[model samples]
Target: MEGISRTYPGRMHIAAMHPSTQEKSWMTALQHLKRKGAIMALAFLSTTTLVSAAEVTYERLLNPEPGNWLTNNRTYDGNRYSPLDEINRDTVKGLKVAFTVPLAPPSVGAGSFSSSLQGTPLVEDGIMYMSDGWGRVYRIDMTKGDRGFINWIMDPQTDPEFATGILNNRGVALYGNNIYSLSPDGAFIATDKETGEVKFRVETQQNPAEYFSMAPLAINGKIIIGPAGGDGPMRGRLEARDPETGDLIWTFYTVPGEGEAGHETWENNAWETGGSATWVTGSFNVARNELVWGIGQPYPAYSPKERPGDNLYSNSTVALDADTGKLKWHFQYTPNDSWDFDEVGSQQLYNAKVNGEDQLLLGHFGRNGFFYNLDGTNGAYVNGEQYVDRVTWTKGLDPKTGKPVEYTPNGGVQTYLPETRLDASVFTTEGADKSYCPFIEGGVNMFPTTYSPRTKLVYGLAIQGCAFNQAAIPEDEYLTGSVSAVDTATGKVAKRLDLTSAPKGGAFSTAGGLVFGTSANGDLYALDDETLERVWTFNVGTMIDAPPMTFQINGKQYIAVAVGPGGVGMNFEKYPARAKDENAKSMANFQQASTLYVFSL
Candidate 1:
């Protein structure tokens, strides 16, 4: 019983799965599985009754037990809000660190950019599953509440030489009898949950520029995966595969093909490599059978003239049919984008009353510095507002259409505030007087936002300041952070809490009347859900660049997050003296560590 068997059951070996160089070793492993799986499956069933955990069903994902953190962003609404209330406003004052588990070494040389803990750890039953930057999955036994011990680890052994982009493995997925994950180089691997044996490994990387970073979203017996590196010369796509056998089901390319519906948006053959990467975990609406995902910036992000016309899918939110991967509806937030504003964040789905009528809405914090609420069913513009300090790119959204005021009717290229945009034709002192507003990172970028049904307010952590275009500085241009609580019903900010550090780390709300957030520095704190007042705080001694999550165990609730210091940020590198506020100064120093910290009352 102690060491029964570890062979993959019903292991599969698909022809031409891996690279040709590794085919021999792979076939050797497949032969071993074929030879030993039959005997080992029997041995596993007959021993000590240490059976594997139950499969994660679609119903469970829809209505997950309050204690278990099932899917990424919990139940797929992209609302990181938990129903657990054991540690409420009255009890959070006594919350403290319960335990810690060390993970793989942080930011090893996996790519050109270093890695960090940009993932949200997933918890099930009493055990925990998460991935480090290098795609090593850790299975930690947490049934013993006092501490967590590593039960097993499954490493994909991704080659850093071929991993070209960021090394951030945002986490993994749990399905039938296995855990699913993507290596840095883009190999999708499935591991047996109970024994840590790999069931199958499918090569997903198509080119060196295309890499996997976000966690896989498993829903309705299919796993959805896409790649990053849209900034490079790579065409982005989203693929849905059969979870059990890793068989490709369907593909949705962000940059439409020549004969596709939206292909006319690109004048030249830019669609071949026009980048609109899908890099974030999307939300699933079970009732509507829709998968809502956000798309990234177009290639040559800062220079939109190279690719004319309003890029079809870049800087947009597209809803697709969950079963067929067919695009249902799309709403482009920034058209012909020239601000490096990639809308590849979260597309939160929620129902709220608008103008005295109940409406299902898709809310988003645009990287171009705006808050938008669109009709969920058809992607129609419902409401829009400027949540950040200012947006210099455009005057504002048109009241009727929600498009930028400067957007032309049928012009091939957009000229939204040439003073703030990067254009070669502009020649004016006004253009020289200002750089860009809300910075290129936006009101919020890849870091997630939270929508609390309890408060009916969507909270977004945003970098509130602006950026200079080409080293030209305006005295007022600076960088800072703000958490804007936008009223979901009205699409207006209810409250804005200014913070001392730019919140690269995201936020999550709880039914306990709290919103937990991490700082670019080292502080993790809880805020009153309604008032946005800091109620409690703890510094992990290193920066937290991951989203904080909560789960309950044995009638007790614990808050968790993946933490480490270095990331691709201004703080991670040396900067000149421009705007030295508490936010900028504190970000200058941080120790490096990759750890899982759990806290409870």
Candidate 2:
């Protein structure tokens, strides 16, 4: 027995010596293998565990289905045009309030300026996702509720760095299975689109002082996010990351580095902190393979002496290669910017006839109060005209060079009267004017513009107002400016709706023969595309700044506005409201309800 055990183990081992037993054993093994195979199949179907995931491509990021708003400007042109015509001009009149999502700040306990719902929101497949300035995101089911219910909310207060309660997250970007939100501290976090669970957080910048205010623009499988500390020492930059793995792909600095073309434009290499940021969302030109963004003013904004020459990328609209952050071309709207007039609003891309030839055009109503038309392909100047009446710096812009000619303001430039520190309020425009609509403080900040495809016209709300007795501060403190829109074809004042003396929001246009915008007084109105006449108006009872978005759901059309107050225009001490709400706390604390109100017929 010992010998047998040594040779073949025990009786079970001997049983295998028989052919029938061996066959039985093989059958048992086959049965076990089948069970294992079944288990493997179940696992494959039950879990999404595959490491290889689909990348968020640029094409996918910018273009969503008919009803989906994929990026900030709806389409890359910053046109905010929706193909859905369910809410045409004829039907929009019948539009009634469909639902209102009261996006209250995450906590009243938190000390934050009461802001309105600033995200225009992207709605698709019965789901609405948006963010407030406080870095809170709400995913709501559009199909189920007469009033949208919050499916998930991610508040920035959960992040320690974002605890200051001052950061503003405008909105979020959605692609594949993830929803991406940028934090005020420059962290790009990806969350499950269905669950709102954070997948990963990529720090785009290290400075906490540099607030992350831009809505992330997903392009061609890359997540593009820029910084908002245009007021600080940090230079502005945008990063493209692999949406799937959160890996850095490329970075484009608004200010040039050493030994570069725009390097000489900065003082003492202070270009390191120059303020050319993409604060507002950018538009993508699919045909051009370019992502165009406008840079903010140079830092210490008021002074041009610290930063001389036309700061290469500052105060300019640049076209960059989407895949590789290469500058394809740029048009500097204000060179040697002395007034802090930044090119920091919407860069509306449209196709128009230039000199009787078809060309891709970009319309910019810069803070300098001039409307510009540039070649979208090469950033060539087609036309630039002064849309505002009170522009005292230069009488007109050189169409060829896109530079303003100082005929009258030869020595009329607003300068600092000594002893004035960097006081922002003292830096107002002091010039003579006729019907100056949007006041200087009410000038266009980082807002958006609307382009009309049917009229081949871009409808913009120009703030026509002037400033006087602006105390001169250091060059840096003086640069903050306003927003406006100029006609691309004529370089003529098609329309200028000044918001200087009031509460104004961004502009929106549609194919339905209408243009829409808001005021600090909570007045939302529609204008005739042809006449720029106010045709329809509604009082939502909130001051607003962010642009409005329109889309269709369940064969019904809706227009949504992101209502928020208190920024530049909300500086009640300066630009006081037409009538103050006595019931509100203090005028400074007169918070606009942060809510997304949807209207449909």
User: RMSD, each candidate, Å?
Assistant: 6.8, 14.2
Each candidate structure's TM-score, on Cα atoms with residue i matched to residue i, is: 0.89, 0.79
Model 1 steric clash pairs: none
Error of 2 at 531 (Å): 2.2
> Model 2: how far is 466 from its true place, Å?
2.7
Relative to the true structure, candidate 1 reaches a TM of: 0.89
Could you give candidate 1's per-residue lDDT for residues 486-562 as a string of tens digits? Answer: 99998999998997566777999999999998866577989999999999999886667788999877888999988
Q: Give, for candidate 2, the lowest lDDT window spanning 10 residues.
A: 1-10
Report the Cα lDDT for residue 214, model 2.
77
In order, candidate lDDTs are 0.79, 0.62
In angstroms, give how far residue 54 of model 1 lies from its true place: 2.2
Q: What digit string (tens of lDDT, one per residue) describes model 2 on residues 148-173?
A: 76666654332443323344557888
